[model samples]
Target chain A: MSSQSVVFIGAGNVATHLAKGFYQAGVDILQIINRHFDKAKNLADQVDAQPADDLNSLMKDADVYVVAVQDDAVQNIVKDLSLPRGTLVHTSGTVPLSQLSNAAPESGVFYPLQTFRADQELDLTQAPICLEASSSETYQQLKALASTISNQIHPVDSEQRKTIHIAAVFLNNFTNHMLACAEELLSKHNMDFDLLRPLLEETWQKVRHHKPSDVQTGPAMRNDRQVITEHLDRLKNEPELQAVYRVLTESIQRKYS
Target chain B: MSSQSVVFIGAGNVATHLAKGFYQAGVDILQIINRHFDKAKNLADQVDAQPADDLNSLMKDADVYVVAVQDDAVQNIVKDLSLPRGTLVHTSGTVPLSQLSNAAPESGVFYPLQTFRADQELDLTQAPICLEASSSETYQQLKALASTISNQIHPVDSEQRKTIHIAAVFLNNFTNHMLACAEELLSKHNMDFDLLRPLLEETWQKVRHHKPSDVQTGPAMRNDRQVITEHLDRLKNEPELQAVYRVLTESIQRKYS
Candidate 1:
């Protein structure tokens, strides 16, 4: 596996982290390819890989070609790439494996299921890499590649991967938005957001051992109309927040009561 | 401070945890008072304190009286209590110190800033205890009591405490609701919510060092309408979740863009 080389087709957060992880795992990263030459070079320097500005420079002998661009950019990039059959794969949860079918006969998905920030170093050992391929041999190759970095790997079909991606949106994207709303609410009252850190930590810890529905607690869970009314009244000035508050409150009440 | 005997007015989640903390810190828990005799006796047995079903059995010699009842019940319980002047404090963030003022002249607050579950044992040493008192001497005594269990103590005023509580609702209550929504979405798709554990852990870990706003990532933050629309479509049958998704998406867009 170490002898089999790979080339990354983007220099974004996902690409940077995946490139670093693959490099650390002793897989030879052959090149960093991107339209933006400087960004490609930047990541290339970190992984000790050559930077290429266009598809014309792509290494044809590489065992794997990972397209880790934005979801919308994936199809276009894969279509333009001239990789050998079964060598090209895209790293997207929502995009279907069929999207890659037009680009290469042996296309697959190597989606890492975690949020990536270029500035922050993530431990990929714990991240689940969802894999899907057009053929079993291609899957075995992708699994071998993914197993180099992550211990948790799953073979999910295209439809299930899309479902997982939607779940990811709810868990990561929407949850982060909730935190941002929390920070905004705290800022308006001149309260330190740090004050909520312990509770935030505790909330995450609870879900690790208990079912979220079983562990849910709040004014709405208890059907405490007085407290809910008080909270809603407090949010009168912020109509958007008030809508969120009311909808979630109603949902929680329906679930519990 | 170990010699300072205290009486708890309720044996709910907050009362149980605080009593355990105080008892562990070597402060003598003199009595556990609750309307329900079984609960009072149950908590009293654990803390090695006397159990009382009514305020008529309240210990007059106790140095500090902690009213840890429900929010609406605080004033009523405090008013009915018969204790020495300046010995009363209520552990409520939203309830004003003045509520206890009518019950005792030296009333204050000893509110711990963390979520508590009756069945879960939490280490109070790391939990922030917000203190407020009517007089300097009472404040000093409450501070001393708080220092015995927790190192993080803050002298927050009534208005500020209310603001803090509201912020807590947003951070803890609403955030848990978001996790619940995520779990529900996964359950519908026959996907394991455990698949989200790493992402959830990462989200909390990221916000610890960075402002949630600075670290926010999602389709909404990136203004990726295609993915957002796909997610909304997936949640078509669940209108309540769709409302939550739309409002949060709009909020994130407003904040970032």
Candidate 2:
């Protein structure tokens, strides 16, 4: 298992983080493949792996061909790969496991469930790696590879993975947009965005211990119509934000009342 | 300043935390007044202060009288207080400073900008206290009392404080509801909420260093209609959640595209 090799088919944020994690965990990275030769070479140098501009140049002998490309590009990448059956996998949550059937008989998914930034250091050990495969043998090999970098390995099928992915968007992507809206609101009032940092930190802390509903507080939760009116009135200048406030307020009210 | 005394006119979450912080900072908590005698007695015992079940029993000589009641009750409590013209203050974000003008001449605000739970211990040093007063002298006095517990004190007016309060809702309360929605979505699939903890922690970490807009990522931000369609289709059963998803998706698309 320690001698298992993985070839990354994309040099993106997920690929960069996964490559570093696998390299540190003693998994051999045989090659970095991407349409952009410079980007491929950049990641290859970091992991001491060979760089290939296309699948034709990829080393087919690697135990795993991790196609960590965009969701749309995943199928094309898989179709071009001339790897042995049961050796190809992609890091996607929405794409079905059956999408890999034409490429290999034993294809699977090796998805890491965390947002990645190329400039920031990622602690993969803390992230849960989701594994799915067409066959039990492929699942075992994928689980073994995931276990090297993370203790939390989940055997989630494509359907369940899609559910997790959508939820992640709500928690991570939508929540970040809320922060942006807050920043914009504060800046318009000449207030520092730093003023809300402690509150934001505490919000996360509360969810970690209590259910979000049990710990819910604010105008809508309390049914304080006055405060809700004031906030909505303030947001009237921005119709989009006003709509967001209205929908969320109605949602919270429905949940509580 | 060490001889400064304050009378708290409530025993709820904010009042309890503020009283404890002032007591720890060596400010004398003269009394705890509440309509609920048992709650007043409970907080009074913790701070070694006298407990009063009515405003008539409240100590009149305290340097600052902190009326930390609910938003709707603030004005009523202030009008009922039989204190000196320049000693009454209230802790509210949206309520104006003028709300206390009829109750006292030296009315001011000592609003701490943090969410509180009575059962949880709060470190005031990290929470900024927003201060406001009718007079410069009163402002200095209120600032001095707030400085005892927290180093971060901002002299924000009623108008600006209202704006900050609205923005805080967007960041803290609304973002939390988003987490609740995510939790509900995950639970429907029999998934463990712990799987999203690392992602949540990382989301907060990223905001601490980068602008939310600069770090934004997802199907909405990328304008990937396919993934968005898949997510919305999955959420079809929960119409409320589906509306929220569509609104947020449209909001993100508008922001980025």
Candidate 3:
């Protein structure tokens, strides 16, 4: 079990990170497969695995075949995949584990619950990996593989994993958009975005310890209509941003008032 | 002067953190003035300063008098404040330095550009302190005083400071509300909030180094209508959340599509 080999079926951010993590953990990586040969080769070269452009060329003997392609392509890839003596898993948050039933007798999910950027370095060793499998045996194998790379391994079902994904949309995607909106507003005013950087850092630091409700503070939280009105007036030019500002402000006021 | 004495006119989060920062830097804290004597006495005890519930009891000979009261109270407080030998400064992001003109010939702003929680420990030494003043001498003195506690001090004017405050509301207040929304969504489904904590940490970590536009990822970023539709359907029971989901999803689509 310790010598279990893994093959990845994508060369994107999720694949690049997980492949590197498995490589660092002394696990044997068999192949890196992508529709684009160069992307496959680039990630494969880094991990000393064979790079393949065709799903037909995948090794049938690997202990695990991880389909890490786009969400729309996951079902098709799994449909074409057939592991001779191994488990198959797709690294997706939204895709259910049952989607892999046509791929292999043993199927599961191996979703790393963190946003990955190909150009940035991510320490997958500390990241939470969500696991779901078709069978108890496959679950144990998936858990073991996940344990090699992460200490925060979670056994989540399809419903729970989807719940986490939606929550992540709010935490990462929506949060980043808020900053992006701020950046746009600052850029329009010719103010340096760096002015808000330290405050951003502090806001995240506070959330790490306290609940969001406990740490909430601002004109909206304090029900300071004057400041809120001024901010709304300031944003009157950009209706989209103004709408966002108004809605978020109203939401905060509703909760606090 | 290195031995200059200061007085604080409020005992709220901003005042408590800044007064402690200056006190730790060995600046003499002469008095803590607040209408609520207990709060003033509590903060004053921490900084080894005298507590006074009366504005008339303020030490006029101090090198600086910091009016760190609420935004609406700042103008009225400055109107009543008459420092005989010290500069008058208000710790506010939106309040103009002109509001303090009648308080003293030398007036300025000493705004720490970070969110503060009174119960939590904040290292003001690393926080950005935005300074604005009525005169060059007062600006230099404020800068010197600010430098004692913070390495990241910038001289931002009233207009720029107000812009920063609006941006802070987005970066801190709006971001926290996003997390609150996620928490509410998860709680409704009997899911643990801790599941998304790691993803939240990584989101902030990525923003520290990369621009938000570059690191943005989600169903909306890819225009995955299926996932987006699914998420919206999941939130259909909560109209407010559903509205947030749609607006944010549309915002992301507008940016990346």
Ten-residue stretch with the least lDDT total in model 1 chain A: A78-87
Over B41-68, each residue of candidate 2 has an lDDT whose tens digit, in order, gives 9999999999999888777677888989
True contacts kept of each: 0.65, 0.77, 0.74
| Best model number under DockQ | 2
Report the number of the highest-TM-score candidate: 2
User: Which of 2 and 3 is ahead in DockQ?
Assistant: 2
Segments of candidate 3 deviating more than 4 angstroms: A81-85, B1-3, B46-48, B82-85
Instruction: Please write out the lDDT profile of model 1 over residues B94-184, one tens digit for every residue.
Output: 7878777667657899989899988887988879999998888888899999988998898999877866776777777777777888888
TM-score per candidate, chains pooled: 0.94, 0.97, 0.92
Question: For each candidate, how many residue pairs have backbone atoms clashing (under 3 Å)?
Answer: 2, 2, 0
Question: Candidate 3 chain B: worst 10 consecutive residues by lDDT?
Answer: B76-85
RMSD in Å for all candidates: 2.2, 1.5, 2.5
Per-residue lDDT tens digits of candidate 3, residues A205-231? 889977887778899999998999988
Per-residue lDDT over B182-254 for candidate 3, one digit per residue giving the tens place of the 0 to 100 score: 9888888887778788788788888898777777878898889999998898778888888888888888788
Q: How well is candidate 1 docked (DockQ)?
A: 0.66
Number of the top lDDT candidate: 3
Candidate 1, which segments miss by more than 4 Å at Cα? A1-3, B1-3, B82-84
